[model samples]
Target: MENSRFWRDPAVPFIEARDVLDGRHVCYARHSHESFSIGAIVSGHSTYLNGRARHRVGQGTVVVMNPGDVHACNPLQDQPWAYRMLYLDTPWLTELQHQMGLGAHQDLRTFATTHSDDPRLFAGLNGLYATLTNADLAPLAKHSATIEFFTLAQQCLDPLPQRAVLAHDKLGRAADFIRANCTGEVTLAEICSVAQLSPSYLIRAFKQQYGLTPHGYLTDCRIQFARAQLRRGRAIAEAALDAGFADQAHLQRVFKQHLAATPGHYRAHSSIR
Candidate 1:
């Protein structure tokens, strides 16, 4: 009991919470998770290994552990660390990605690390963790707060730049072709054929270059188009069709499942600016 300062809530279906140890015995054994971990150091200092780099944690610092990144944490000589963390599944983050209109980024492909010195975000997260641990939040409130936390985290992190087109003639041609035809239901097979590589290799190369699989990138294209159409007063039915959905229902399901809101709801609630 003395070595265990950790408290773990029942793993929420899609999220998990942990109150971690601090002080001389503070330790997180080398481990990885299938979901992203967002951690806040409440007191003392923490030294954690992430991927190939080891980082020191302090008050107000937020550490983002991407899925599958080998990480370990312990207290510095005399100082230990106490932290609260939430692990989030990829589907949840993918939904946020769609809502935020984020593009493919290498940082998103796996785990990442970021910080927030912003008083509002940092304090808000601390309060949220308290509520989560105290069982004081309703389901709806909990979901909303989680979304807010992610939005703040993304804001604090530097987004990667759009991919650069190579000067190579063939690759440039393929890239241009893909960009131009993304919304036209271009299949990965077609892209592979045009690029003169097998589908598997092409997918690898495409992801290596674009930071998303070809199909995933293409879906983003469709979602972007739908967002534009929704903003312009198009009915969900019409927007879905124009955005290449099989039907309004198809669009509605995907929109709700991936973006956490139906198209109509998103349009009504989101800022047009």
Candidate 2:
């Protein structure tokens, strides 16, 4: 089957959309971007990771990622994963938020959870992606679809809470260090040093706070970076080196283990459109 199709309409410059078929075996590393993204799982099942929480997402699941949120998804067992995703730039989304009566504060708007089973949101986002990518669609129709999608998204996905827990500050610091150094070798000692906690303490605390070990978190980060490189048409060997993997084979192994698809397959099938 065709691996994936990605495109951005000139009319909707702020959004990029992708449709993936047979992605249940595909895995993504922990990563983030400067845009707000939403995905609707049209078929198959996968596990979604957002922060420390994990959700089993299947058909009709709608996943949202706020800018800079560390998250990933992969298929369950050998099941086929298929979905459609839209990435909306921050400025564009901010405008939509304001139009939806969300105050002008960009920072105040955020998707609280990683995924939802909202049928309405799934339909709205799916239709919006399709409409935006249709070159023959009228501008007015695209505009209407964009508005309707954002309105539904904003209504369904809640904003981040205002309060922070003092106890988790160290964990946050550790995560930040990992993210910053994800494309390089990261060690437990280094993380502990940064967090100012002992190794055992940090390990337990980090897992408790983020639902993954430090090493697991770092792996997710590297994989995410590698995916970005591959999307840009980089070679498998180069992407592996850049993402801090031991070698191309290692990257391939990890990529398939988490994402079910090979780097070469992904690269060959992707196009800017």
Best by lDDT: 2
Where does candidate 2 have its weakest 10-residue lDDT segment? 158-167
lDDT of 2 by residue, 13-79 (tens): 6777778887753567665555788899998888888877788889999998877566788778878
Candidate 1 has its poorest 10 consecutive residues by lDDT at: 2-11
- TM-score: which candidate is best? 2
TM-scores vs. true structure, each candidate: 0.51, 0.74
Candidate lDDT (C-alpha), each: 0.62, 0.78
Candidate 1 lDDT, 45-119, residue by residue in tens: 878666556777788877776654445667787775677677777777766765787764423433233444566
Cα lDDT of candidate 1 equals 0.62
Error of 1 at 105 (Å): 13
